[model samples]
Target: MTAHPDRTAEGVWDLTVATPIGRIKAVVEFRRRDGALTGVASGAGEDVPLRDIAVDGTLVTWKQSVTKPLRLNLAFAVDVRGDTLEGTSRAGRLPASKVTGTRRTTPARTAE
Candidate 1:
């Protein structure tokens, strides 16, 4: 069953995040289980689970740490409009960078 557009952020999202090095691409998957929201991001040969995921209206926020290409802790705040998302990611005390993402029409599959 499809989730409500305004209430749920459960889906796979393709994200383009800007960093000091360059623009990196990642896929994030959000899920709602047992009344809690959880997510994971896959990129740069790393798949890390999102922390402190909170959703309010269309606004979603989460924290993640990555250790490939660079090691940094990231905090994300995005506004979800339908299938698209726009926001910023901040690394420690550095300036925030633009972050844009779109919900994937087809969920990614693993090789079996």
Candidate 2:
């Protein structure tokens, strides 16, 4: 079988959100496993786990749970181009907020 490109390359994502309070920034680190994406978000002094990552061509979608007494679910979509990623995020709740971000290169390995 032909070898697929390694998806486990770690990368950094810089996100901007337009909230009622104001615009907020979030930096997320993502890693891939067998073509599935997984990562963590660094926001509000916490590292939150990411899930439900899907990649279709240049489009990517994933869910991030923001649980700090109050549970908030955030869904994101990004477009991958070359070594960069650009996308938007929205809340699972009604009247969703819009978020945008960029992904940059990080460290990578051959295997986990």
Measured by lDDT, the strongest candidate is 1
lDDT of 1 by residue, 10-80 (tens): 88999999877789899999987786778899999999999999887788999999998889999999999
Tell me the TM-score of each prediction against the true structure.
0.90, 0.69
lDDT score, residue 64, model 2? 86
Model 1, position 52: C-alpha lDDT score: 93
Pick out the ten consecutive residues of candidate 2 with the lowest summed lDDT. Answer: 1-10
Residue 37, model 1: Cα distance from true site in angstroms: 0.8
Give the whole-model CA lDDT for all candidates, comma-separated.
0.89, 0.68
Candidate 2: stretches off by over 4 Å = 1-10, 68-70, 83-85, 105-112
